[model samples]
Target chain A: MITKLAYKNILGNGWRSLINIFILSLVLTGMIWMQGLYDGWSRIARRQMQEWEFAGGHYAHQDYDKYDSFSLDKSFAAVPPKLQDLIDTGDAVPILYSAGIIYPHGRLTPVVIKGIPAEQNILRIPTTHLRIQDPDTQILPVLIGRQMAKSINVVKGDILTMRWKEVNGAYNAYDIQIVQIMDTPVPSTDMGQIWIDYDKLNEVKALKNSCSVIVLKNQAASTYVGSPWNFVSIDQSMKGVDAMIQTKRVGGYVFFVLLLFLAMIAVFDAQMLAVFKRRKEIGTLIALGMTKRQIIGLFTMEGTMYMLLGSVLTATLGLPLFFYFGFQGFPIPQQMSDFNIAGASEPIRCYYSPIMILSTFMIVMAVTVFASWLPSSKIARMKATYALLGKV
Target chain B: MRKLLILTLLISVSVGMVFAITAEDILMNIDKNMTAKTTWSSSRMIISTRRATRTLSSVNYSKGNDISYSEYTAPAKEKGTKMLKMKDNLWLYDPSTDRVIQISGNMLKQSVMGSDLSYEDFMDDLELLESYTAILDNDITYDNRKCYKLILTAKTSGLSYFKRILYVDKERMIPLYQELYAKSGIKLKTMKLSDVRKVGNRWYPMHIVFKDELKAGSGTTIINDDIEFNISIPDYYFSKAILKK
Candidate 1:
């Protein structure tokens, strides 16, 4: 009998129920979208971070960088010679680099050029980043990011100039072939980066002996260490990249909350008015043999039925948006992508996170229950005569 | 017969004193020689798995300050370059643009060519005797050199390498082998010194071999190809204006 009454009240207002359901679904759609974005961004950031950390991210020490003390000393070549024998004898990633300065064609600015050999567009740098590819070299030389390449006005086939400077304030530039350009991965990297091939750079710098950094990876079972004037990290040095990746992720989380919060305010207002309009009816029920629990249950069930209808409509509207973006993300403005935002190196790709979507629906149910709480509890507390008679 | 016996005993005593030199005394002599500020020229080669790369440079090194000037050459490229360091300031000049720019401290973290050397490793001039006290650890043969195994403990913190055990040569007063230890008491690296040569009345290390503790199979070897010592170099070459490249 109670369930029958609950069903009647749900459709009691005819088209009014449709209006309420539409408003609630719209609010829910916003909440789901925002929540999905945040969760998606977080997963992408973590995956990318893991890749970089495994690639010697921990070796890029920021604390030690403050000393203003790094240079190539032609006098201290104590460690370079036997490096080849060890690489051949042991299993080690051929982590190598060569540094030089280059002035891109048309752009006269001489920039610090670097050539990194190996995979280019993966964890650390995303693919949408434009780089000039080398046509001839089997080893693809990369062009640095859009902003840097534009500033230097370098396409492909431009000659890069390298100058070896000594402590005596004298230096001479060596000409290097420009095979590729690399994008400045982050704002920090963008501020100081140029491009060339690793082999060509080694030749020009005459640094078959000098490499600025080494990135190495080998099978896990094959390693060991000694007196380290070096360092180790918590995420194994994942934090350096994490700090940058975090900037792009925070947006999605906040947007989720914004969507749900706005919907909640509207829900609260709608319920308040609905409950007030039904006061006379509630008063009569309380005056009769209906106990306070029965009155509260009646109003709560009616509100829940409306919410159930709202959720169905909301999910129908929301899933398609997710799939649309999952296939083809909304394009970010080129100008905005180029700007120096803290975490996002490139424009983001929007996608879905299953956990986020499920969690969001649960959250909406919780909010709907709370929104009904005030109205139902009031129904329980209504006075018999004043509530029913429409008293002044 | 009594006078002859006394003269013979005195001569024998003098010869014994001449042959016996304590490890501490030898270290003290090397420490003193290290104190003199001087200029020198050397060609160093970094030997790696990929290829051999070499740099020929003239250097002016000073004690207690990071002020030095190096005029380096790319023998392979027919190129010459100069760098100057005054205190903490560094600069390098681009002969192409004729422009000078300051180098950041981070560049030093890079490996010196294809070798096991860092930029800080190249500046390994401060002998432990000046900053730390040495104790004879034990006798050890390092790379076939008979050595007085000695342990050195730093009196101060923040040194480049804190705890080191050196296997010093018994005859030449040079460190034939060295073991570097971490703060946690783990051995970090092992280094061997070989090919000792005399330049201008003084003996200097001509070659060094280093092995990483973690990369057990891989190591670095550095050879100083050309060596000159006690040459004159200007002090002003070590300044901010000079480090710009």
Candidate 2:
């Protein structure tokens, strides 16, 4: 009977009811949109990290330390026979790295030389550029990232002199031709990096059958335990990305609360007006036979119905916007390419899950009902005789 | 017969005493021929890399072993570049930037003018015998000249090269070849001197080659075109004001 009365009053209010529903719907839509974008951003970053930087995971030499560059000189050893078989079968790729100095246009710049197989599909680096069939000239083909090329002021076809220490600590230098400038989202791979063929780099460094790290296609296929090598897991390697996403999600919650506050304020104001301006209606209900508790219950139910309708309204408007953006992702700004943000080099697409949508709807509805119940509870303390005279 | 045997033993003892030479004496002799109170020199430095070879001409003024100033005079791009070395410190003046940059810490390890020589190589001020203990290895012929091979081991842990093998010319007391070794026993660099000439009473090597074994290519060759020893150089020449001029 209270529900019937509440339904009649909402329909009778018309425009006033629509305004409350509209505010709730707007807040719900904004929350959903922001959540979807953040989810999409993190998803892409993880995907790119897995595809380009860490393929499944890696096994590195026991002595290899990335932070200490001096270790690069002594951090390599011959690949074990078991891992060698995986590399031979195309399930893994061996990377050899060392510190080097390059002279481009008579300026000396320090760089790290990474050697990988031209035929391996383990990492997303463009290794085909390192494959050159020039038998007459002894020029080695090398690939540098776009940032490195820009900083060094070199272009494709430019020949630069590269000097590095051999395994025996002897220094050697040779001319290298820039075959390609690679574009990668990961700055660690591109900045101050030079990629060459695995065999050619080994020959240049005078290190035969040696590799610094072995990247595997399947991280769990083989156990490299008990060996003098470290097995890095994908989760451990991509921990930075995970931490960044979690921090961003925390910031997103602040916005969610602000939107919820705005919507709650509108519902609270409407309920307060119902208690004051509809005192005559409240008095007549009490005089006729309705209890004060029943009247309060009706008002709270009315506020909750606004959220229910708002959710429906949001679905009608927001679904189309989500679908359109999901199909054609928002283009990432050009300036973002220089940012070290992992996986942010690509455009962002909105990701919507049923659980995310339903939870947002439920939280908003509960807050709206509480905002309505607060002012409606004041009616229970008013004198019925004074309310009947519309003086309360 | 007993008197004749005594006379033979005395003659053999006198001959052995005359041939005895200590490692310290050889090192002191080489140092005496190499060091001077003050010197004024004009030379050309040729640095060869895998890409190309570049030549730089400069004039240098030095007082003792601690203070020296060098100004580049050739190569249109590097013209007006000056380097001043006071003891262990090195400062470079660039005409393009109009700035003076101090080469210190890791910057000392970088190549100078894309050459195999580093800034640390230029500011080497340690006296040889003070930091190293020497031993004579053997007498050998190098570059068609009879020489004494002297092995020098660093007395302290702080020297750049832990050990050095030097071949010194017997007559001139000048080093003909030097092999520098790292603490790990790795041969790091080699220096060879040729084209000896008599300047006043002292013999000097006009052509010198410094090869860094850790780098590829032919290394750097410094040819001394004009060398004047024991010259009075003005104190203002080594000052910072002379760099811009």
Per lDDT, the best of the predicted structures is 2
Candidate 1 global CA lDDT score: 0.53
lDDT of 2 by residue, A186-243 (tens): 7778888999999888876777878898888988755754466788888877787779
Q: Across all candidates, what is each one's fraction of true contacts kept? A: 0.12, 0.00
User: Which parts of model 1 have CA positions greater than 4 angstroms off?
Assistant: A1-4, A14-16, A42-100, A104-146, A164-172, A181-191, A195-259, A339-349, B1-245
Cα lDDT tens digits for candidate 1, A1-392: 66678678767767766776776687677666654554444444444444432343222222223112242222211113333343344322222232333434321233444444333432254322223364333232444555665666666565554333322222224444434454543443454454444444444334453344333343232222222212333254445445544564566557656755655565565556667887787777777778888877766666676678888897788678767765565455777557654224433455555676677667777876676666667666567787788641
* DockQ score of the complex predicted as candidate 2: 0.06
lDDT of 2: 0.83
DockQ of each: 0.06, 0.06
TM-score of 2: 0.65
TM-scores of chain A across the candidates, in order, are: 0.70, 0.88
Docking class of 2: incorrect
